[model samples]
Target: MTLKKGIVYALLIASVVACSEKNGTEHPDTATPVATVIESEKLKFTIDTLTDKLDNPWGMAFLPDGRILVTEKKGEIRIIKDGKLLDEKIENVPAVYDHGQGGLLDIALHPDYTTNGWIYLSYAKPGEGGGGTTIARTKLNGNAFIEFKELFSAQPFVDSEVHFGSRIVFDGKGHIFFSSGERGTKENAQNLGNHLGKVLRLNEDGTVPTDNPFVNKAGAKPEIWSYGHRNPQGLVYNITTGELWDVEHGPKGGDELNKVEAGKNYGWPVITYGINYDGTPITDITKKDGMEQPVWYWVPSIATCGMAQVISDIYPNWKNNFLVGALAQTHISRVEVDNGKYVKHERLLEKVGRVRMVKQGPDGYIYIATQSPGMIVKIVPAN
Candidate 1:
């Protein structure tokens, strides 16, 4: 059954409305509704509405015990348990700037979370010059935080509220990697003195690793692993291949999917496929001698946010594909990559609302977080 785009939109809207109604008043754990059935090139699947109770959800982390912790842009951490949104927000969350693009952001659990009990968060932290991206870790005690520690704060905090690139991933080697945007200053992406506009590597305890790319480089922040990025809101580390990937926003066009590498420079304003937001060219060149090119890029700017790769076998047809959240386009991009190169892509769940995050749950199902009528939806194999 070939599902037309129009039918998919209608079914998605109806399902969203129905799901909202079911969770609006009582917030009960109702059976998830089949939002829509999608027939892709390889397999058919159904999207199920898990919950519609979030507000501007930015990121999510699935717990080992089947619970999920979600971060809202307004500095709240929410929990979804037994397919229901818990009314009580997690207590003792750090204060966030919550202006423009800054706010509570991505969350991830430590690889040894089951044993160490550390949960990590990246957010826009309020400070002197203004708020900037910060990474912290804490342990949850019931619905509250305990033993909270500030891990890494992006240096020279500025007042700009937009372009706080942030995402967290573990490389399974006792090291963590996170990204920070240029904080609206394009030039900062190329500067080595500041933490902004860079992918940073740190030990689990917030210390810079000795082997980080810039560790011994004078005049550079030791945490920097790669430089020259815009607002990179997505970061994922492939454990099997040890490759790190990032998806970042471009000004007008040229949203990029990068195979991020340590010590490499990803050209941003210096060389972009995009022009300035006001229709002026930032640079006429898209290639530079020493800068790295993107593995894939979007011409019309999808406002890429969170991303995750398919490694589980639950959806064999979607194996090894990347799922990127499309904010401006309001869909999820299923990108097929072959040996570090782009092959083909498809847009899934169109018009479902602004997608903020797409993640694969511990159960091997794909989960998506969207805003407007904030909700979490799941894609499972159609029976």
Candidate 2:
């Protein structure tokens, strides 16, 4: 199904109504229902299943040697070498709280990985207070992760298992950044003293950066780089622009794509284009002072998951676009952004199952992780 631009317009109209209902400025939503698929130029490709078996794979990274490392949300790391799924899982992964939304999540490699053999992982650690997002680093040596050390953990871990916004990314510098959800508590997104619903910056060794925006501020968590985000699961740092792009799930609808910047507040419970899952209004206002706006949003959310920039010549026309995995939509949203503006979006890989992660492979093809009989596949030109 192709998504037409008209759907975006109609969604904006409904969003206005949703916002108005919150402020008592309008009665209720009776607008025309928006269509899901936006019509755009479609491409032809053949999906080759590299491996038909992965257990709820969440995130993936391509090794410099063309092998891939995939994270199964069930607290294991599976590796694919020479296009074959290795029978054994990598060892030394810590135990995870694999209930509800908590589990093993995103994984990334150091910029200088070849020299350092360092890899980072974001997982939900079970503790006294249910579970919380945690980041740790380990040495990848001969099919095993050794010398595992905790880098950072969200403070005051809550008892809920939902909204663990745990995606890890390297800033191309020595600094590492990861996101944390509010753990099912909406108001926690606005609290400066907590790590929930915030993007944090830290040195590779888990120390807060001295130049972080919240550093030296009174009563603010010094690790916080940005706040007021919901359950962000997709984070990518654009090497060309040095800008961090993030995508997060919203209640009912209003999934968001934001350009994360230091110290910025991305309105969540305060201002949103979405309402509660029970159809209750979250905020009447979508725009507020001191809150940064999303670059784009989805009404009737796609339940967005993993994301990666498309910069390879293997797909020439897709250069400068982003391949976003849509779990609910079961397609890849090809979003085109130019000069800090979202130009348009198209859907790809229709009927490929619920896409969990999308990444550009070292060989320049597009690799995807899918759920429901979990599998790892790649898209190559239909020659």
Which candidate leads in TM-score?
1
Per-prediction TM-score, please? Answer: 0.94, 0.88
* Model 2 spans with C-alpha error above 4 angstroms: 1-42
lDDT of 2 by residue, 144-247 (tens): 88999998899869889799999888888789989999898889899999999998999988998899998999999999999999999888887778999889
- Each prediction's whole-model lDDT (CA): 0.88, 0.81
lDDT: which candidate is best?
1
Weakest lDDT window of 10 consecutive positions for candidate 2: 11-20
Q: Which stretches of candidate 1 lie over 4 Å from their true place?
A: 1-17, 20-32
Superposing all C-alpha atoms, what RMSD in Å does each candidate have to the true structure?
Answer: 3.7, 11.5
